[model samples]
Structures are given as C-alpha cells and as structure tokens.
Target: MALGPIQFYCNTAVALICGIALWTDCSSRRISNRLILIGLICTGAVVLIEVYFKGDWQNAGGRLAAGGFASFLHGIPYVSGQMGAGDLKLAMVMGLLLGWDAWHAYMGYYGLVLGTAALILCLVPAKHKPWSLPLALF
Candidate 1:
C-alpha cells in the first residue's frame, strides 16, 4: 500500500511509541501506563485529524472499531495471566493507528515481525546482563 500523509504520520508516531515500549519492556519487563496513555492520546488526535481533514468518517469509525477489537482479542492473554494489560492497551493504540480495513494485513505483518524476532533469538546466543539504565543518568 502506498503511504499517504496521514498513514505516514500514524506509522511514525506508532514506531516511536513502539521503540520506547521495546526499551522499557526489555529492561524492566513492563510497559508503562504513561507510555500507553500518550499513545492513546496521540491516536485520538490522529483520528480527529482524519475526520476533519480527510473527512473519512468510515475510516475513522473503522479505527475505533479496530482498537476495540484489538483490546478484546488481547484480553484473552490478560485474563489467562500470560500477558499484562499493557500489551492489550498497546495493541489497542496500534489498532487505532493501523485501522480495521488492513487488520488482516496487519496481523500477517505482525506475525512476520514476531517470527523474525524469534528466529533471530533462536539463532543468536543471548547473554543475561543487568541493564545499566541510562535513565539513571538523568
């Protein structure tokens, strides 16, 4: 799919959010509520921008529905005690950014990413080292 202006904007923000999420998750095995809140707020702004400028109400609605669906789907893991609520909330924001129409593609792409990560982990030796958080520098 060709990247439109709004899509570019959405992807960029989501990428940044995911980057921070990766860092915190790797170091602490936790996703912060503040990060999720920021992502959600940004997603809300992007939806409003889509509705106002693009005037794509259907797409806007799809974004909302996608978010809800994502939360519902990820809720299973949360209920099973296999995953944290933060994962579900983060998926919700991601769904809002990605929209419902491309959910099939999104899932496939997401699976591919995860598969690649797993493959890399399987092939590479991992060393357990304590995180010397640079956050402590600040």
Candidate 2:
C-alpha cells in the first residue's frame, strides 16, 4: 500500500524513538524514565490530535505509545530481563504508528538481519568477560 500521511507519521515517530533508544542508555539509567515518560506523552498527544482534528482511527502513533508503555510495564515482571524497556517501547510505538497495515514483510526482513548479527556476535569469544558482548560492540 501507498504510504499516507498517517504512515509517514508512524515511520517518523519510530525513527525518532529508535534513534533516541540507540543513542541513550535508557535501560541502565534512571534518567531514561523521564525520557520514556516524555516520549509517551508526546506520542500520545499526536494520537489525540489526530483523532480529534484529523478524525484518524487508523493512526498508529497512539497505539505505539501505549504498546511501548505496556512493554515497559512488562519488564517489571522479570528478575532479570532479556528484553530492554526501550526496545519494547520502540516496538509498540512502531506498531501503533503502523496502524492496520504494519508492513510485516519489512519488519520480518529487518528482524532476520538483527538476528543474524546477534548470532554472529554470540559466536565470538569475549576477552573481558564470559557474558555476550554484542551490545557492547555497538
């Protein structure tokens, strides 16, 4: 399907969230809590605006924000978690912005690339410690 205004918004929000998550260590720092909260508010505002001003029911931004929030909440259940709150937040945000037509094909391809890179990193030995260091390399 052709990308519409809503789709563009989704792509942009996801890009922004991903960029922030990649650059900032929201997982380890308390400051990330504020950032995530701000992000949620900003994203939620976009959705509210769209719904009221643009009559948008399919815009993915609001849903993405909620999903990101849910992901954060889910992280609380684990003693030590594998999924990062930022990553989960980003995924939900992307999903919300994607709306009903979330280009699963593209997501699948990207997931494959990420998994391959992760696998390759997992195969490598670490000098400093025994734990996996793929994230450290980046």
Off by over 4 Å in 2: 26-31, 58-80, 103-106, 126-138
Listed per model in order, the count of residue pairs whose N, CA or C atoms clash below 3 Å is 0, 5
Residue-level lDDT of model 2, residues 51-77, one tens digit each, is: 888887655444655465544544563
C-alpha lDDT of residue 42 in model 1: 86
Q: Where does candidate 1 clash, by residue pair?
A: none
lDDT of 1 by residue, 1-138 (tens): 787888788888878887888788767877899998998888888888888988889989998998899888788877987677777788888889878876777678767876875675577655743323221001
Cα error, residue 33 of model 2, in Å, equals 2.5
Error of 2 at 64 (Å): 6.3
Q: Looking at model 2, which ten-residue stretch has the lowest summed lDDT? A: 129-138
